[model samples]
Each structure stands twice: as structure tokens, then as C-alpha cells.
Target: MPYIEVIHPDEAEGRLRRIYDRVTGPGGQVDNVLQIHSLRPHTLEGHMALYKSVLHHPRNDLPKWFLEAIGVLVSLLNDCSYCARHHAAGMKRQMSGDTEKYEGCLEQLHRDHPGEPFSDAEQAALEYARKLTIAPGFVVVADLTPMREAGYGDGEIFEVNQVAAYFAYANRTVTGLGVHTEGEALGLFPPDGEEWRHG
Candidate 1:
């Protein structure tokens, strides 16, 4: 159980209901994270706004799916179960609801080191996120070359790095707050063609 009780949309005030509608009305449901945030509706609104601005920025070339994959990888590397499960559920959604691929990626490092088995690009991004997460002080211009060679420009690379960093922030917040799910949802990535439970 979450340290704070989750608030259902119907149970929310008008302000939070608006946030819930915006988040869910694109044929998607409000996720558990937001539900937890509903405990403080105004803060949820601000957080969602920032998240949407970053996610839907017009110049971003990397698909949301790939960004989410990075989120999962970073969360797992950090050993944050709450974040890991959250991003795993999102990646599971991207894998077209395939459990095998979803679970398999969970075990893979996704970074290319010597003898590492991942795409050159995936490796680059993974290495970047890991370094940023584990040792933010050590990142340099040289660290970005591989990603550039793999076709990411400065904006995408910055976005990728920021997303990785933000997820770490998210991990700390959710974990520190003792956020949890009711076990009704299997992972962050709910299976396709299945209804994701609402608050």
C-alpha cells in the first residue's frame, strides 16, 4: 500500500478530476503514479504539466516508447523496484504486450560494453544514463559522441539525459513516499487490449 491513500477520479475534486481527464481522455487511463499524486491534486497537476511538456516536445525525434525503455533500464540499474515495475509496464506496452520480450529485457543490461550484447545505440544511451545516474559528475562532451554517431542530435541527447535524470528523481520520490500498487496491476506496462485499472 502507498504511504498515502490513492484517490479515485470520481472521488477527486474538480481540479484533480480535470487532471485525470486530460491524462486519461486520449483513450488512456490515469496511471497509478498520478493516482498517488491525487493525494495532492495541485502538485499532481504541476508534475503532469512538466511531464507532458517534456514528453510531447515537438522537436523530440526519439519515440516515447524508446524513452520509456531508457526509463526502465535506468530504474532497474538503480535497483528501484517501484520505478522498475513502473517502466517495465510501460515497456511491456511497447513490446505490444508480449510478456516474454518484456521480461527478457528486464534481465539484459542493454548497454554495449566490451562483449556487451545490445545495439550500438542502445548501448550508448544505456551507458550515458548509467553514468549520469551513478556518477553525474563525470559526464563530458566525449560521452555524447557515440549517441551522436548513432544519429541523436544535441536536443534528443539532452532530452534523453534529462529523462534519465528525471526518472531517478521519480524513483526517489515514489520510493521515499512509500508508493505502491494494490497488486491488481501486474506491472507498469499493462498488457494491450486489457483495461488498466483506474485509481
Candidate 2:
């Protein structure tokens, strides 16, 4: 379950069918997050496009692991465990399956004691993500000072901004619509390419 009816990959047809084919994970499965957009397939297209570009694009100069950590932290702050758990698994893999290291990282995030494994600049980004997630209206340019002081340029800061913002949108969608990870293939990364590789 989902709160709303979702078209299963096997049962999908036409445009929905095509989209599902491209986004399927293990065993031709579509995550509930993606399938929930079935009735309006184009939005699914937009969502996946944004997801790929934001989290998996080649142009993102930030380390993919760091971006995944940002996603996990932002999702946790929003109380969106569905997204958090998924991203945590991905982050663990990105860190080379270092379970001890991964758990320590997560503990730091949960306790807001960011350090070790994460550089000072990374900690600043995480702090910025917390503010943006919990109080977006109150965030100001002054906030970027710490991140810059920690060594992030404006563009790298923007990557932090985008990843945090994207997770906020995604977390809300999951929480609002009651999406779950019951059958999701955890930790699957977005495909890399100029365009989706059609299957």
C-alpha cells in the first residue's frame, strides 16, 4: 500500500507502460513513490527528470555520497522515513558498505552532532539543510556565510540547496500521499546518461 490506487508495472499500458519500463528497479518493479503518479504520467516524467538531474547528474560537482547524506538528513527532519531509509541505504553503498562508518554518520545526523567522516564544509551544508527543511521562510543569505566560511563556493552551495529542496518536496509527497517502502527495491540509484536508457 498506497493511499491512492497506483498502476502496477505489469498492468500499466500506453504512456504509463513506457515510463514504468524505463524506471523499473529489481524485477521490473516501480517504487510506490514513482507509481503514485500513474494517472498523470507526465508529472512522473517531470519528477524523474528532476530527480536524475538533481541527485544523479554528471554536472553535480559535489560528491554523490554527500548529496545522499543531505537527502537522508532532510528526509529525517521532515519525518519522512520512507525517503530517509531509502537514501540511507544508498548512502551506505556510496560509502563502500562501511556499516560502522555509515551508522556513525547517521547517528551524528540524528543527534545534530555533525562531525567525523563529514568535513566542516559538509557539516555547514547539513546545518543549512536543517534550517531550510524546518523553517524555509526564515532562511536568509546570512546562512550561506558559514557554508562559504567552511569552503563551499556559491555553485557548490547551490547543489546543497537543490538536494535539500528536492528531498523536501519528495518527503512531503511520500508523507502526504501515504507512500511506503513495502516492496521497493532499496538503494537503487538513478540511471546515468543524457537521456533515460529505454528498456
Best by the TM-score measure: 2
Clashes of each: 4, 0
Error of 1 at 68 (Å): 1.2
Alpha-carbon deviation at 102 in model 2, angstroms: 1.5
Which regions in candidate 2 have their CA more than 4 angstroms from the true location?
195-199
How would you encode candidate 2's per-residue C-alpha lDDT over 77-141 as one tens digit per residue?
99999999989988887888878888888888786647877889999999998999999999999
lDDT of 1: 0.66
lDDT of each: 0.66, 0.86
- Which candidate gets the maximum lDDT versus the true structure? 2
Q: Superposing all C-alpha atoms, what RMSD in Å does each candidate have to the true structure? A: 4.9, 1.8
lDDT of 1 by residue, 116-137 (tens): 3346776687778878888889
For candidate 1, the 10 contiguous residues with the lowest summed lDDT are 190-199
